[model samples]
Structure formats: C-alpha cells, structure tokens
Target: MEAHLLPCKISSDGMHVDVQAGFVREETDSISFSGHSVQKANFRGRPIFGTKLPIPPPYEAVLAHPTDSLGDKEPARLFVKSKVSSITLWNLSDEPKASDKIPSAMLWLKLAPLIHSDVTYSN
Candidate 1:
C-alpha cells in the first residue's frame, strides 16, 4: 500500500497556527465510493508515528484542525520543546499574519497555561 502525507497547520498552546508541517498516520488503503478495504502501510526509511516528516512530492495539503472530531470534541494538549523552529502556528482568528512578528503577550498566553509549577514536565 502507498503512504500519504497530508499537509496541515496545527495550533499550539501558544495561540498560533503552524504551517510547513505534515501528518502521517497508519491510514488504510484508498476507499472508493462503493467499497473499501484495509491494508498494511510500510513506509520505508523511517517510521512516521510519533515523529515529523518533511512534505513530499504530490504536494497534498489538508487544512489541519486541532479538534479531535473523531471521538472528543475538545482540542488536543500539545507539549512542545523550547526553540523548535520548523513548526509554526498560525491562528488567524487572533494573529492575522502568522508569518509576521509574534507579540509577546500573545506568545505568553499560548504557552503559559500548558506548563506545570515544577522544573520540568517530562521524566
């Protein structure tokens, strides 16, 4: 089976939409209007789960929504590392031009609440 990467923009706790990213999940074979079937997708070179991959050929980009409409309507809780440049968040509702400079207050509002009152969040 062929693997596909759908380009999408994701919002972080820091109130912005990030482009230049893609999503690769363990999806099934292409399903037609009449029928569908399941097949194994073995992506060569590297694993797509729990990691990031650069956008590939064919240039497929789907609007990325942070909401988990499949089961829970609540938005996801993302824990990001410090100084990750490749991932960008673009929240047009707040930040009109995400490519522009990010206001300090806006940046703090997005990232502050997600943090714990401790030294680090991970073990």
Candidate 2:
C-alpha cells in the first residue's frame, strides 16, 4: 500500500484537495522498506518510519467515502473503496513499536475475547 505520513494536521471538515499527484505519489515513490517490518520515507524533508501490523482475525481496515446526493431527511450513505487485512502505522520520530498506544489498543482487542470467555477447568 502506498501511504504518506504528513507532519501537519488539517483541521477542516469535508474539505477536498487533490493530493494524489502532489503528495501521495511523490512521497510513496521515495518510500523504502527494511526487511519485512519497517518502512522509511521522507515528507517535506522530515523522515518517517512505519511498521505493518496485521489486523487480527474477524477484523479489517476499510477505506470508505461518503456518497454524494443526500436529501434533508435521508440517511447518509458511504461507498467502500477498499479493504485490507493490515495497516502501516507511521511515526514521525521513530519506527512504530508494539508498545505504542494504537498497537497496544490492538493488542487489547486480541486479548479481550479470551479474557471474557467462559472457561471451565476439568480437574
């Protein structure tokens, strides 16, 4: 997957800008992967590091967009653009680690089911 890690955040809602040509393609073109775990890229002169994590079973990463044409009383619709079993979590200062907040949260997700399951020991 081609992804870029931008340093700044945009605080606007529903604002569309053409980033494919100016940002994504450019940054992705320069991305370099180390072994199978780490990815490196430069965005606007700042280095970026990323690690790929597989979304555990029964879960996936979805890319969706709001569908146009909504009436005043009609519910909003979304169009699914793509889906993936894993995601590349990017960090500006360092390679993403399992100890990071998001990764830790994913770990909790994996453990929650087991923790809450009803198990009987036959002794």
Candidate 3:
C-alpha cells in the first residue's frame, strides 16, 4: 500500500452529513495549543482537543475501501488507498489521555513488544 500521512482526527462519536461539500473548512490559523501542547480546534461551535501520536515502529494505519464482489467464487477484496504513520486523537470534553480507549489501545501497541520480548532482567 502507498504511504500517505493523513491529516485526519479520530473522534469517539459519529455524525450525519448529507454531503462532503462543507464537511470541513480550513481553520488551522485558529488552532490553539495548550501548555501541555495539546492542539485544540473549534468544529461547528464545538470544542475539541487532540494530540498527534505515532503508529509505533513497523506499523501503519491503512485507509481502505471494500470493493464489490467480482463473482460468487471470489472472496471480497479491499482497495488500500493509503497508509499513515501517525493519527490525531480528538476528544470532545478534554484532551486525550492514556486512559482513554483509543489512546490506551495505541499504548498497548507500543508496549506489547516489550512485554512479549525474551529479555532478562537482573539487579
């Protein structure tokens, strides 16, 4: 899959939109950063806080779409549009914490290798 750094944020909830014409508008200049460096933005009058997190080494986020079946004998296929090394996690109430679901999952991705490694510890 071709690698592409997507400038997108993952949200906890979903929205109903009819068209993609006015879904997103450029508000980068209005973006504010807190003392902790958490990026904040206003979307449709709602405040959202976000932080960019890496996808950990050797892993990437793939953006794909399922294609229609070619025939009954063939299995379904996915067309990978692009891949990203990092993604922004956005929260409606507050900044994303390690305790949050998505953040915790990402943390696990980084910790799983260490936890499963064959390394030995000595005092």
Candidate 4:
C-alpha cells in the first residue's frame, strides 16, 4: 500500500512531536500524535485508570544519552533484563505536564493510484 503524510508540528518542549505516522484501511485515513514523558501513574484497582507522573522539564544542556560514557553502544543488546528497569524509571520519573493540545497542520494531497500497473499491461 502507498501512504502519504499530511502535516505535523513539534512542541516547544521538543518532548512531543505530532505527525501522520501512516495510513490504513478504506478511503478513511488515520493519524497519530506522540508525547514524551518521564513518569506515568496508575490507579490501583480493578479496571484501573491512571495518569502519567510528573517529570522535570527538558534540559537541552544536559540530558540522557542513548548511550553512556562507558561505551556500551549496544546497551539494548540486553533487552530482556533492561525492559523492567526502563519501565520502572518511566513510571516514577516526572513527565511533561499533559496539556497544550497543540493541533497539527494538515495538507490535503491526492492519493496515489493503488492498482498494479503491470497487470493492465499483461496479455
């Protein structure tokens, strides 16, 4: 399937970026916006609903590196052990204030032809 991007924007904090990631199904379209956060909260009960925890603002000067000084370039090479540790930090760390529902810009473009061109040429 061929997909087209509509339009998108970045948050002032840079923690969140919005975009039309991809499309699927019918003439109808799909879109998505993602936000970055340090913390998430959980309501402890049956059918629990929760809120994300609060995190410090993004600091451009100093921030977490995808890798560390020790040179573990492929730290994620240890996925099984790291997943839990990562989730724990995500749950407890402070996240961006969940506000500022900034709207993304949209671009209307004609969809590309989807049928197989070679099929029409075959004898």
My TM-score estimates for the predictions, one after another, are 0.15, 0.64, 0.61, 0.14
- Candidate 1 residue 108 C-alpha distance from true site, Å: 2.2
Model 1 CA lDDT for position 28: 44
**Candidate order by TM-score, highest to lowest?**
2, 3, 1, 4
lDDT of 3 by residue, 1-123 (tens): 323222355464447654336434232333323213566666567776676666767677888878998999997799987776556667774766778777678778888988999988999
Clashing pairs in 3: none
lDDT of 4 by residue, 54-111 (tens): 2222311112324334555645322122211111111112222223221111111111
- The parts of candidate 2 lying over 4 Å away from their true place are 1-35, 68-75
lDDT: which candidate is best?
Answer: 2
Q: Candidate 4: lDDT over CA atoms?
A: 0.23
Tell me, by TM-score, which candidate is best. 2
Q: How close is candidate 2 to the true structure, as a TM-score?
A: 0.64
Query: What is candidate 2's CA lDDT for residue 17?
Result: 73
Show model 3 residue runs off by greater than 4 Å: 1-36, 70-75, 119-123
lDDT digits (tens) for residues 1-123 of candidate 1: 122232234346876543324322343444322132222222333332211222222333244335334456665744322322222222222212323333243444455655744575776
Between 1 and 4, whose lDDT is larger? Answer: 1
